[model samples]
Target: MKYILGIDGGGSKTTAILADETGKILGKGRGGASNYQTIGLENAGQAIKFAAAAAVEQAAENLSVSWADLEGSVAVVAGLAGADRPQDRERLRAALLAQMPVNPIGLRVEHDALVALAAATGNKPGIILIAGTGSIAFGIDRNGRQVRAGGWGPILGDEGSGYFIGRAALTAVLWEYDGRGKPTSLTKRITSYLQVTQPDEIVPLVYQGPLQRPEIARLAEIVLEEAAGGDEVSCRIIADAADHLVKLISAVLSRLDWCEPGIPAAGTGGLLQPENMLWTNIAKALAGTHPQVVFAPPMLPPELGAVLLGREMLDTAVGQEEFIANLRWSIEETSQS
Candidate 1:
């Protein structure tokens, strides 16, 4: 059996999927954080190995076949966060190869953003704006010329990101405590979310405690909830986040030129869903400047984009409609199970 594997790894969790040559998704698996930049090389490799092995195991269950029946030199592609640099890709490639459960053929390590664009546009010229733990905008033109904006990590940039929202909310809470800012529901919501009663106690926890970046980023959900419930401070925080995200998209779109009808622009990541605060604000904001931008849904998730790249390595054709339908149905069935 000609098998393909796709892996999407980030700071939060890693996902793996198995697909046949026809681009039909067979099974999927998930593992822990595989962002080597934060989790270390060995841990990242092990996480990836665990996810890929689990995917094969799921495929075995789906097909009622043994590992020996499916094992081979599988075509593989891994799109990982914090892997944009060549040295990072090479290092991860070496580490992943060492710990792989099966022999890998044409195993390519790719930046997660590029695969996200493919997921959004199917290799067509377009733009993808991702705003999860971090935010970035990447755009490609007709001639394959690409431009990227934002994604500078938290200390420097990562504006319009979950971390940004969380950080801003925390600041707003402190400001309210000091009477320097307007009183809003965020102060109470944030204090409860952080498991602290007094706002003054937040300083010690934020500075010296075990509060990591991801933990702080998780607070973005709380902020979003408050925004949805009509908290003034939360609403402003989310609106500011949307503005920053729009700036990133605008900077990228400014550098590239795509013809009329509309440019295919897609939003991914947990915080970038349709009708959400950021998505709604971003769409409204972009409509004026980039009127020709068409908001499009992703044809496939980012991991499947990796799968598509793997299929390309084999120089084969896949029936797009059949594969897409099968993939969607299999995903729904497996998710329900």
Candidate 2:
């Protein structure tokens, strides 16, 4: 039997999907963080191996198939969060090959942003804005050209992302504590969330060791909470974040140059989770800029977009029902585990 493997390697975690030639999913696996930037090139290969092996083993057990019999897989696309630079992609690809057993078929690595884009629109044209550890806008214009904006990472860019917002909140907390800014609830909430009584405690945590993206991003919730409770400081921060996020879409839309109404744009990642006001604000801002732009709620997680895009790379058509069913199966299986 033939098979294809698709992987989505995020900053926090990695997902692996095993599917048959016809797009029927056999199994999937969850593994440790595979962001090359976070985990380093030396460890990326191991991370991918662990994640891929877990999925392969699960699929083997569930389908009663042997690893040796697993035919050469095709188009093993990996959409990674930090594979922005050409060097990063090269490193990730090299790492995948070095770690995995040699297969006759090949693997393809791409920006996590592009995978999210493909996931949102399938083979059709559309735009995808992802706000997670980082923020980036990716789209396929009507002419089939791909354009990307603002995936420069948290240090320099990543505006409107959870990490950015979190960092902003943390700074604000320090500001409030120093009497440089108005007293806001974030000053207390952030300290409490980290189990500390003061901002000084976080200085060591943020600088001492490896800073976790999601952990830092958790502060974004505090920012949102303070804003919800009517803190003007928090509101202004969120509003600014929303504005920064709009810039991502605007950059992509400018490249796409949509001359007509009904061009689809979708939101994804941590910021777009249900009930997320950050995402709502972004949509509202986009509306103000492009009155005719259409918004499609992301139907599947961006990782699943990596899987589906892998299938598409083979020139295969995955029907909506089957695609969603595969996603449901993966989610259910993961949940049970």
Candidate 3:
């Protein structure tokens, strides 16, 4: 039985899955962050190997193969965050290959968003809008042409992201303090969130001090709450976030083949909850802009998407239908286990 290794790695965590070419679920494992940009190459490499080893360890318990014998893997697909450029992808490929148990025949490294879109579209033609710690809209047309917008990180881009929503509220709070903006309840709440009595004191904490990107993203929840409670400032910020995200989806859709009528698009990330203000605002806006677009949640998780992509690299490419069905069915068991 030939094995395939599929990895979904990001700044926060890493998940690795072991499956046969037939899509049989063998084992699963997790490790720390593998984003080389944040954790550095050595640490990211170690994290990838650790996750792979743990998966192989579980596979050793369930199958005939052990860690040392994993060289029979047919392919490996690692969909990693921060590995955007081809050079970065090559670097990550090396990182995953070094001191690893498996010596797969085919190895590929892809950006995390691509894997998310694959999961959403089942490798069909579609677009994925991811607004987590960062934001990016990536699409694959029927002809395999790919296009992306946003995802420039906290400073330059990441429009419609948690960090973007969070920063906008905090900035509004400061403006309110200076009497430049309307008085809103977020001033008090955001001040408390920042742990400062006066809103002006947030300057040092935000500019020259702590409040990392993730830390700032936490404030987005507060903004969401305030918007639900009818806070004008918070409501406006949420609307702006929705507008940015809608534009991202529109930008990708316009460049693709189905631009005239519309196409499939899915939402993936923290702020995209169905019950939330952001989701509603974006949905309403899209109803007018692109009526034929069917927006929904991701069809599958990214690791399974990585699995599908790995399956694509096989030589014969037969039994694809069975492979997808079994993979989907096995994911339920894996999740329950």
The TM-score leader among the candidates is 1
Q: What is the lDDT ranking, best to worst?
A: 3, 1, 2
Candidate 1 regions with alpha-carbon error over 4 angstroms: 65-73
lDDT score of residue 50 within candidate 3:
85
Task: Give the candidate order by descending TM-score.
Answer: 1, 3, 2
Better candidate by TM-score, 1 or 2: 1
lDDT (Cα) of model 2: 0.76
The parts of candidate 3 lying over 4 Å away from their true place are 62-65, 260-262, 315-318
Model 2, position 23, has a per-residue lDDT of: 61
RMSD list, candidates in order:
1.9, 2.7, 2.2
TM-score, candidate number 3: 0.91
| Worst ten in a row by lDDT for model 1 | 64-73
Q: RMSD, model 1, all Cα superposed? A: 1.9
Instruction: Provide the overall lDDT of each model, using Cα atoms, as 2-decimal numbers.
Output: 0.84, 0.76, 0.85
State the lDDT at 239 in candidate 3. 95
lDDT by residue (178-226, candidate 2, tens digit) is 8888888887788877888878787888888445667788778778888
The window of 10 residues in a row where model 2 has the poorest summed lDDT is: 65-74
Estimate, for each residue in 1-337, the C-alpha lDDT of model 1 and write its tens digit.
5777889998889999988777767778899999899889998999998898888888888785444654574788999998978999999999987787667667899888988888788767899999988999999899788889988899999898989998888899899989999998988887887889988888888899966777778889998899999999999999999989989988988899765758989999888888888788999888877898987567777777788677776655666556556666666777788
At residue 200, candidate 2 shows an lDDT of: 74
Instruction: Write out the backbone clash pairs for model 1.
Output: none
